[model samples]
Target chain A: MSGNENREKYKLNVGKIYEGFVIDHIHAGRGMKLYKDLGLEKLDCSVAIITNASSKKMGKKDIIKVECPIDRFDLETIGFMDHTATVDVIKDGEIINKPKLSLPKTVKNIIKCKNPRCITSIEQGLDHIFVLTDPEKEVYRCKYCETKYGEQ
Target chain B: MRHLLTPLDLSVEELETLMDNAEKIKADPEKYAHVCDGKIIATLFYEPSTRTRLSFEAAMLRLGGKTMGFATADSSSAAKGESVADTIRIISCFADIAAMRHPKEGSATVAAKHSRIPVINAGDGGHQHPTQTLTDMMTIRALKGHFDGMTIGLCGDLKFGRTVHSLIRALLRYKDVRFILISPDELKLPDYMTDEIKRNGAEYEEITKLEDAMPRLDILYMTRVQRERFFNEEDYVRLKDYYILDMPKMELAKEDMIVLHPLPRVNEIAVEVDEDPRAKYFEQVQYGMYIRMALICMLLDISL
Candidate 1:
């Protein structure tokens, strides 16, 4: 099929949700990981993922449609992961709210502590949390281990 | 108030007060011996440390306080998979204050979260060793009589040396303090440090040759270049003995230049150099104990 036809098919594949959230502007290949991080994969509600969607701003983007609106904590965590990602709460097939996207000062139960000596690495039932040390650089270090989140 | 997690937690006034108390205690040891009459300090050393733990224990004992707790995780419930949060919670019940030395970077913060009593971070891995920074600062303040207008030459492993990082941060608060970063290119100070120095508009130079920087230094802080931190053995061997302070190098330095080392050295400072009057690492050890004693009193809210 032609490129336009493929784009049409891809749009149809991501059917609208009656009530939920649409996480948009996700960097082209990072949608699945963000979906997993938000625990949307384990949800009983219907979920649709549109990968490599054409975008004017991002060149390419991914979108996630969850049949349930995510809570503020999860939304904030998502913003922390990818500041460009926008969350739109949908109800009765209408976009009701677009939550502000900003990096959180501290994130809980998101990035895992990879440092071997970190208490979270050795201890059980402890949530992995990170604190944003350098806001300008958007750098997050583990709250317990202080290990830079992305490097390790 | 209940925990000493980072140097930033203590304001400049509090730090000066701590140093003042430490000096007073040192001058008249008998007067402050029973200051902490019935108190107890728990030393939760998850890693093996001779000086830090002993300094803490000795400090507590000298204040007439009892010392208790494990030296290693293997001997405690930590080996059985106990969390730092849980351990600190349990330790809070047994001791009036606690001093913890952990291999983890922020494990002390984790312990502090659950601890009801005061928690002092003896040392945390490649992160902050606030107490040691306090010791070094106290030592400098004692010898120099002020923190301002000092040129510090930090040699050897700046990359993995937590003490060097902490000392630099602490000293930056003072006026017109310049840093002479002496290290091999492979083990240079991390970008975070240099970035911070630049942000403060402070002066610093990265020089590979220690002897070249020695003559201008008022304080030469030497750190061990550990073999384990390197990716390859060849690079480790090449950089390990990169900056040894021998007699000739010491002679090149100023007559009153203070040579400081966070000890357990592996020939980083030549044995012959220890006999020099400028070598103050031994005095630094005593200051470590006195500072901890002052810190324990300050944390527990006990008067002198």
Candidate 2:
């Protein structure tokens, strides 16, 4: 395939792999790194963007943008960036989604309240429901486990 | 219906007004259940405080109002780097009144700075917890018959207990009340507080031993020596069990002397003490809910 073909190869449909947080690659022409998770130690790249993912996980629905070397990464690794962005992408013109992700009265994580005595954080077989009490502050609680809300 | 951000907001008359309403609620809770109907009290707990948050929410609910807010940090927009002002500003539009707790000193006051609705400070990071003071006031009035001429003992974590400081400030409003401070030297009352004690002409005495001070005490209020407040875990480990009260300790007091605690106790009092007629902490907690209920009812101007 031609070099232009290589550029469009991983274009937009890049699988949800290859560190979805990868938003840019400013080739510095030196040694770089990859897969900080399993300790890839090092790789070759100019500059890479890592994310402080506020949303907890990465998904295609959250993809702010992705910039890359085109051939070096795979789909799954790229999917992790689904919810984050690189400053370069915005400078290069990528719009951030205005609608913030929220914990709508339902949740997925097991309750982890420090109060072991708290009912919802302990009792089994109950749905963990937490309304978006404050969107600016990401907080949640088990509805059944914490009954103060119900009493209200 | 302004924010109860500090004890200063509760003038002696307003404080008595709240106390009278709370006492009325205690006497007949059902009558006031319909007081705050159709109103909402958004309890924005920026910090996790099961008891304080519950007290306020229970108050609103019992008064026929509703509540909606988070119980922890991860559950708030603070996780998203949202400012306190932004959060309270939004919650105020939804609630007729709100109560909040934050780890930072003056955070509730900061929230009050922007809130259009009445804001209550349930507790703010070792700073102010005025409702607990009101709870203490209502409790003292109910159990001891009057706040005047009473000898009040505040035991444990006195140096760092916001509730203790708030209670002392509130007690000053009463006549001839003498304070007996009991705690480890590492946790002695704050000098600023002692200054207030002196300035108000309220008499006080500091004691390291609870049993030593028990005989003369009219009200013995216990507070936990928080593990986090100690710079040395060894100090807390060495001192917590040392200050605990058992059934034997009650013998040193007047038969009708009341015992109060900010609940969620970690063995500060023996479980067996729960049976004693003098052990009023549970009822105190219940009264707390009613007092908060009455306050919310009056603050929001709802009809019972």
Top model by TM-score, which number? 1
Write down the TM-score of every candidate. Answer: 0.93, 0.65
The positional error of residue B248 in candidate 2, measured at the CA in angstroms, is: 2.0
lDDT of 1 at A104: 90
Task: Please give, for residues B149-257, the per-residue lDDT of candidate 1 as tens digits.
Answer: 8999999999878888888888888889999999988888977678779887889999999889989999999999876455589988887887788999999999999
Candidate 1 Cα misplacement greater than 4 A, ranges:
A1-13, A69-73, B227-238
lDDT of 2 by residue, B1-304 (tens): 5778777677988777777887788788888777777888888886778888988888878888888999987999888877777888899888889888877555675677788999988877666688888888888887777889999999988976889988998888889999999988878986657867988999999988888988998999999877755667888898877688888889899997999998779989999988999999988888788778867866776533
User: Which residue ranges in model 2 land beyond 4 Å of their true spot?
Assistant: A1-152, B302-304
Q: Clashes in model 1: which pairs?
A: none
Tens digits of per-residue lDDT for model 1, A37-130: 8887787778888899888899999988888744523767688868889888888899888889899999988778777756677666777888
